[model samples]
Target: MGLVLGDAWLWAAVEWSPPAVAEFYIGGGFDTPTVVALLVAALVKAALLWLILRAPAPGPLDRRAKALRRLLYLAVAYALVLRYPIALLPDAVDAAFQLALWTAIDVLYLLVIRWRSRMLRAAAGAVFAVELAAMADVLLDELDLPELGSGYIVELALMLGGVAATLITLVGQRRDGRWSRGTQTAGWLSVGVYALVFPLDVFGRMSGGDMTVPVMMDALGYVGTVWIAATARELPAEGRPADLPPARRRVIRVAVTAVAVLPIIALIHPEATPHLTYTGWSMDCYDRPSFGDLKPAERDAAFLCRARSTEGGVPPMFPDSLSDQEILAYGRALCRAKDRDEQRALLTRAGSASARSADQWDLVYVCPEIVGAAHPELLWSTTEAEAANAAYIAEKNAKCRDPWPRTKGVVQATANYFLFVDGDPGYLVHDPEDEAADEAAEQAMGKVYDDSTRVGVTDSAVLIGHVADVADVCLTVKAFRTPPPQRTAGWDQVNEVPIVSRSGQLTVPEMGEGGEVGAGAPMPNLAIAGKGRYRLRVYVRVDDAEEEQHLVVVFPGASRKRLKLKPRPVAGRALSFNSPSSGGRRAVARGAGGRSQAELWS
Candidate 1:
């Protein structure tokens, strides 16, 4: 009876998410709190075992069953004691205490009297060793060592222990004869539980499913095998406790455990398809393509094809082998060209890169923005691009300009993203003078990310993570003729990077309704219309409990002839992402970030 009750208690813990667990199981009174159920069950188990001292041994069978039950109860004791304690002791001392607890459990099983099976004892040792390693992870943590495989250690150990126990039970059933059919069946059922659980723990996570799924599966299996063994009354025992109980009693125990565990899992876990939370253009061709793999023309095409909003969901035509240098030269010449027709003719010249790809919308939209002071080359640009640019500047001047050097505005923090204010998304995709881009990418993702890591930064973009998931942020953008002697008051973090613009037009591109499937439209882009390097210093303040503020300041930079810039690797959703619960309202903080909602890549 005590063992049967333990099964129900284990089920209660399955609703582990806490006060959120349903007040009533189904049509009412399943209202047991998880901790209360576990504590009561632990006491009941201890009480039943201690009562053995007052009476003669029931039989060898019952004594062996009691021995097994004692080891199982320690799981609860471990939680009540060590697991719940806020370890105030030194690292080595805490480690030693846990080691001691596992050692005592192992000793108890080793002294199993009459019906001991060698394999079952071996399984106990396996459990002890695994648990010690899992628990000792905190020691390495305290020493400030890198957490090598710490996240999955406990789950892996549990799976391995289940494998050990399952095998031993099956082997013991045959070797220790005197087992009834029901007892034999219980051994096989344990094996089935392991088979179902191990794969979900491994594969489910790789596929990006919620982690809780596998844990819940393991819980169901745990409660199940215990229920089966409890009802069959079959284990290596002095009285051949492998003997089965009456059919009616067996039915009652089976019914009790099933009723306790299955209902809660069914009621609590939502049935939903897996939603992959990746950042990329909805129509993007691939992620972080290797520049070295493509020829010059293909590489240029690849760059143009990357996350940029084009009309009708169509990607821009290849750059037609047009390099940024060639385009910049064309813009410089157009500076001397006389009228709109001459400017149009200059771009439309036969066999030129511009003429060869004159019909592409991105090139058209970007052409005017790049050649900032040139003729109104509406022939190579679109009305929409012209209109967006005009409105953007007007809004900027109204809010940011009147304030003189600093312009304060509310940046739309949509879908947890902001800006990639580069003149070109494909900047330095093919430069050979330096390998900084590749090295920077390797460094950004070279190690596992920790909980505090809210963002990823590469030469391509600055991944601003909403650590607190703030939707809209108040910020100021200022253009400086030179860097300030020191950071202004009120900012908490600071960094300066060189911005390279091919067209001299820097833009803040944002995602629209299409999400990762489509390269998003642009917000107002800054027309820094000269092909030169510039310094951008960003100051971020996140200490505000309600809002995040960023100060972006840009200034001219001297040219460096050491090496050509390497395009940095982007990480995460380079385009954009929306959490399932996001209301679809867009508010992005895209100052140092890049075009499209996709922020970065691996």
Candidate 2:
């Protein structure tokens, strides 16, 4: 029975992941290979047990043999019962059922052995009781009553009980006339092997270390079981061994003791054993191809091919067979080419169409850098290259100006501004400055600028000029109370002044050209209370314009004065004004108002 149980554990450790015992009867997932393998193994074991039972008794059968026969019968019955029903149960229920089944088998064994010897019976009964209690404890643990700590306590008791039972069985076999010397030796050896290996196997499993120790122990245990079974069959009914020579007896005892101590020493100092080294690739290198074994020419060709396969325009290939000097010369010439087209032509002429072979993308990208390291003169300065490339791109964009509508009045306003209308869709005011051009281009392409045009006021007359066309223009001249200038150090620093109140849009005709549009008089209700400098702002929207005209009206006691407007590019947006501080002040006020208010101010 001990040998049979030991074999079961040994097979479990050797043949299964998470051990076969868990997968066989308890683990869910019936379609798994593990469950099928276990079922097949159980069937094979049952067939073997039947064959063993049918085999003729070697001489007249003893009490031990009869007990073994009964145990074998129970084992076969248990295997058949567990094979189908246990597999069908839920995982938790299956685990509990397996535990109960094993405990019942142990109890039955205890009952069978009781008639043999009183001391053995008591020990086996105690072991059985302890095992049953341990099963109950496990079931309770699964229920999560952790305060009980029944798992640990019951496990310890179960181990002690097993040890006691083993000792009592050994004593009974020795004293009773049912075992031979060979059988006794085999039985003790089996026990000794189990004692040495089982704990180490358990520890290895718990600690999650290498399975080598447990596997070695399991093999040793199987050998011991085989030895015990063979010796038991050959032994006589009156199972006492023939007397052995003193020297041979001492040698056998010494060998057994040495075998038992070795596993203990190994468990205590595992590092003393030689370990197998893993040579698998690291995480970073796993995806990359190893070119260490490839020829230099082949490696280079592979790199070139890889670069071509990646998304993006394929770069012209370089020859794999080029010498370092030749490679350096080629790289220098490629870098110094007048343009990208010239570089592409030079690379195309030097490369062979048939020689393309893909390698790592990174290697291909850095191929020039790799060869250039040998001759620093051949390596292009990255900073210089980047600056030149940027200048070239800017020049190209500057030359590729958008074709504006040819209108009689539309002329390049100064060198930086131009105004034109494309049919009646809208008027366009473009600033020749690169930043402004880019913004105008984006607005032109998108064609949705309802909130783009706006108006605002400064200390002078209302400045208005972001109109795309004057056709859709509307001027709202409002009188706003200007906040008191912030005082710093007892003197007003005039840091900021904000609009406090306003009237509705003044009745003024749509603006057309530069003329006396609003009687050229100070618009009524445009004056604020107190000695504050009041200004009237005219709001206008040219068709599809991203900017609004902000005309500032200045009143000098009932008379309106118009200031000369000079449109200048300020931070990519064109603001038509002559005052140097107007842009900065307007920006500060707009920023203070936050985004929505800033949009309104604009």
Query: Best by TM-score, which number?
Result: 2
Instruction: Tell me the tens digit of each residue's lDDT in model 2 across 301-400.
Output: 3333332332333433443344333444555565456665675676566673423332212243235454444433223333543444344333423432
Worst 10 residues of 1 by lDDT: 423-432
lDDT of 1 by residue, 490-522 (tens): 444455555554455433333343222111323
Candidate 1 total steric clashes: 45
Off by over 4 Å in 1: 1-20, 23-57, 60-69, 74-107, 110-128, 131-158, 169-181, 197-237, 242-602
Give residue 190's error in model 2 in angstroms: 4.0
If candidate 2 were superposed on the true structure by all CA atoms, what would the RMSD be? 23.8
Q: Enumerate clash totals for all models, in the order shown.
A: 45, 20
User: What lDDT score belongs to each candidate, Candidate 1 first?
Assistant: 0.40, 0.39
| C-alpha RMSD for every candidate | 22.5, 23.8
